[model samples]
Target: MSDKLTKQSIEETFRELSNWGRWGEEDEVGTLNNVRPEDIVAAAGLIRRGKVFGLGVPLDQPLQSVPHKRWNTIHTFMQDGADVATGMFEGRLQYADDAINLPTHSSTHWDALAHVFNDGRMYNGHDARRFGSKGFPVNGIEKMANRMVGRGVLLDVARFKGVDSLEDEYAITNAELDACAAAQGVEIRAGDFVLIRTGYQERFWSRGDWAGHTTGMAPGLHFESCYWLKEKDVAAVAADNYAVEARPAEGEGFSYPWHGVVIPAMGLTMGEMFYLRELAADCAQDGVYEFFFCAPPLNLPGGSGSPINPQAIK
Candidate 1:
């Protein structure tokens, strides 16, 4: 044991451990908390030494949903083909003249702490006042920004299953996650952004029906998995699924158990609909499981969640 075993030192040790097939079931969770800010800085330095990659899909119109009557679009023009007598200037000027129905409901985004709660408190022990007129302070996305720039490990679960996509209602257990990480020759660490690719982003606009077409986590995460993540002290968890957990709890009948467990109780943030294909491909090509990751959500007041344009730099 080294006396200088700061958090950063621990992260580096874990990164090496991941390459050597040392992960899970042997104090992996405890290692996350031991990660030091200096280690994160060093990891970031490595990322900057290489090429930076962006991992986000553009926001588009809704493919399927229970449409609202108020949601409609109208386009207006400031100038349309005005011909001057002498010069003959013909051009069209367009501004905010178009009002399209923005999809506020179906957001492929990161949920802020305010998004979910256990009892009534949120992250950092802030109550509704931190939220002020906005909503929940703990729910604010700002707190998460600090933890966004560490190592990120991608677990290509869909590829492991030998399919372009996982079943719509597939539930990923801790064992499955661990297995996928092992197959990829990677390990999960605290403060490390964990990305699970389910191949759903490939089907973003196939039929334009977002309802039944879009795939999410089976129901919600199993309680054990949530506990595992919390114990690991990961900065955040990103997945291609809607919620990190299964849709509904197994026996409890609640729709979102992971949210109840991770958010309010543990104060963890969940990233949804992240673009993982490119990231996964890059990881495989370079054979490097750890890379610098960055994600800063929009600082919107009173917002439950916001669209995130995240990136992973190797």
Candidate 2:
């Protein structure tokens, strides 16, 4: 906390709390080491109601163009013709396919440890030179694909604050997170996929104002939450917001400090732009806050991040 929100503080925290050598000097999977195979077995016990909810935002064609330089995904829909050509498949075997081209940090995506770098260093002190102009030479998103499965706990901050969704520029603090946990009667344990819902995206969906949602001010995670997350030893943290941290940033002359610290420093992957309204509603209706959370990133080798189709089973 001495370094506070400055780049100096981020460096200090990385030196103090990094899992760089805990796994290995050659380790690419950072805090994902906290996720054990047995964690999945125990997570299955949370499936009493046998309900499943997807967390991916629907990626449709000609996605909304937003300000601040972060636009929606581009999905080109296509189909196989019923008329057969030379060397074509047999009749009645036509299908559909879509080619998607977007930023790796697209809707409902996972930010790999290499997503951010500091001073020519990546997670665990890996050299940024390892990252080629094409993609990551190490610590790729594929390394995290299988490692991102485990228990998920939702802290619905909007509901806790007596609002359908929090106002723009609201940054969630550790105290607010604690209050949500207390209200749900759940203790955040190690190896949990801690998901915080700000309810911003869903409200935008109702009004069809993705432009306003994406370009305008919004809620996000407090930088202090990074320290709390590292202390708690969670496998990863995800959110319903785009950057997962508030903007314009709380730190003076520092923008998106937590992304630099948490992904590159703490070695934790962050999920963003999730569709958590249904899951939040389900949890509230049944009063079950924790669930079997399972989300494996797409196996794109050398990818810094991947669009993920996450799910919560309860």
Instruction: Put down candidate 1 lDDT per residue, 1-314, tens digits, no spaces.
Output: 01222334333322322311122222212223344698688667756447766766555544233454322123354433332323344364332223333332244567776776434544434455444554543345554444456677777888877877776556677788888788888878767778888776566555555664333334223445765675566767877666666553432323454565566545556787676777777777877767887777766655667666787887
Query: Native-vs-model 2 lDDT?
Result: 0.80
* Cα RMSD, each candidate: 10.6, 3.0
Q: Using lDDT as the measure, which candidate wins?
A: 2
Model 2, residue pairs in steric clash: 3-9, 169-218
Tell me the whole-model lDDT of each prediction, alpha carbons only. 0.58, 0.80
Task: Write the residue-wise lDDT of candidate 2 on 1-314 in tens digits.
Answer: 22336666766766776777788888888878887888888988888878899999887522244554545676676654533444366665666566867776756789888778866779888888756778886888999877877889999999989998887878888899998999989889888899999988877778765665555677878877888898888999998877888765644334667777787778888888888999999889988899999899989988888888898999
TM-score of each: 0.70, 0.90
Q: Which ten residues in a row have the lowest lDDT in candidate 1?
A: 19-28
Best model per TM-score:
2
Model 1 — TM-score against the truth? Answer: 0.70
